[model samples]
Target: MSDQLQNLDLPYFAIFLTFFLAVLSSLLVLAPTQRGISATWDYLKQVKFIERNGIVVSTYIVIAVSLWVVVMIVAPQFFMVELSFHDGTVAADVNYDYSQTPYTFNNYSYVIFGSGSDDSYFNVLHLKVFLRTIIASVCITLLAFVLCYPIAYYMAQTAKGGTVRLLLICLVLPFWVNEILRAFAFRILFGSSGVINSVLIGSGIMDEPFDFIKADIAMYAGLSYAYILLMIFPIYNAIESLDHNQIEAARDLGSSWSRIHYRVVMPYAKPGIASGCTMVFMLTAGALAAPQILGGPSSLWFTQIITNWFNLGDWTRGSAYAFLFLLSCIVFVLTVMKYFKVNLGELAK
Candidate 1:
């Protein structure tokens, strides 16, 4: 096998060593942790706590959880992580024959430092686009939160039965259309010669049309609108179960509306706020269609970079980019949880 290996770049020995190291690391890190968790779960089962709490705690449930973790999270991410560590150009065959080549961290290095011109701990171009995506996504989350919170509050606390149902229908109606179609609709509406521009021209408000897409205002608006429901429903669900009498008591005690929300409502809705923000931020960060359709020429989303890498037949690079993007999202989620002081366990509720 070594004689058949004619490559030095992605050496077979390196691959074997890397694979060995990865397996060793996994065992070293995961063995005790997994053992502890398994022991704890077993203890819980022995005590009948899980079953007493309405959980089945059955073999089928255990199998399902194992299968979900292995299939949904472990297997895919393991392959991607492996791919991200490989040097595709060196020993990779036409079909990514990595037999002769070992995995390398060059893919990550390339994306992070960009050929080492200025190895100042950052790849300027990639970092710029990444930060732009993060900032824009954060802005979209905040805008959606601000825009939907009041509406959700009204629907949950103030609206009559008929009005609440009607508002919910209105909220969900737009989602009946596909997300891609909605993005395209925004494209036409924000185009230079589209509805808004035509209206301005016809009304004599302006002789010229404004280019929303070119200015990237359309991108921002589209992203906010794209994930607006994600921001609304979580908040609505959280607020709906609140005791209305507390609000009434606050009102009777001369608490203003803003005060009522700030002191009472928002504190109760932290979990929903965290959940909504996490969803909106992640969706906007990973959005492809809305940015592709409504973003300006200069507006570059980081996901597009990953897409381009895959299109260019570079799965290793694409996987590296994806992992980095995923890391950023995880970091953002953690930051949100920390800031809002919401437990991950609470997000599901």
Candidate 2:
């Protein structure tokens, strides 16, 4: 089965896949729903103005959106998904001809079970890394919500115009620095002989430099800081859109602060919370830089493993790993949507 797919045509496959996706999307968009076909028709009708934008302008806008969806979003993922089912070794042998690669699930098998060898029959290490990545990502999402919610609420509800502007400046200023530079700054702060340890030892707080990096403290801190803004803004927007009179009514009815938030604020903010959580979880799970720079010697991120496979010219296996990660993220998003009862339309709003 080494060259089983050698006769396959690449262009034909791409065209077929694109056609299939178009049909699928059409069905989804045209389905009978309150906000599906009807909403689309409304949008189209609204496009026709009294001082009309020309048909050419509208055509250009549609073309631009289509190109962005197909070229930027769909094509890369389609190629990756296609690559995941093939054999990289055979492709490499045939001068990187993907058409010559036979299809196999050996890559996914390797993810589930070790090379069919006697000594290591289970891929325990990689599985553990996958689980660790998921768990850490969830923790980070929760932590970001806990930390940012109050600030978002303060900015959206309590703070005056100038105070809100000052808070926004403080939040946005740090992120203006490049992410890599920020990661490096974290490394310097948490490194063995870095500032924290230097201060501790110099001031007689501790005799030896504590290993914050080894404890994975820097990784958590860095990842949290990196995605903090993403978690905050969605929540702020949601809360800001809420009617302040509702909160006042709750208070007038003798509701405590905690009860008011739990009953009134939280239910209204579900869409924002769900959106923030999904983004943070996915970003943290797939993170490379913070894991690379702030992670300890003993630490390993799932993305680093996928990157290694690609770096070693095993694009097939890398694609499989990446696709699997993507599937996991999709599942997480669906679960969150289900739990929060926040659909795509609400999140979009």
- How accurate locally, in lDDT, is each candidate? 0.82, 0.82
lDDT of 2 by residue, 47-66 (tens): 66223767788778768966
On TM-score, the candidate that comes out on top is: 2
- Cα lDDT tens digits, model 1, 1-349, are 5654555455644764565455445433333233456786887678886567565556666679678767876678777776776677774667865545555777877887886767475788888999999998988899999999999999999999999999889989999999889999999998999999999999999999999999999989899999888999999999999999999999999999999999999999988888898889988999999998888998899999999988887888898899778766876777768777877756777
Clashing pairs in 1: 10-101, 15-102
The window of 10 residues in a row where model 1 has the poorest summed lDDT is: 26-35
Model 2 pairs in collision: none
Residue 284 Cα positional deviation in candidate 2, in Å, after optimal superposition: 1.0
Count clashes in each candidate, considering only residues at least 3 apart in sequence or on different chains. 2, 0
| Model 2 root mean square deviation, Cα atoms | 4.5
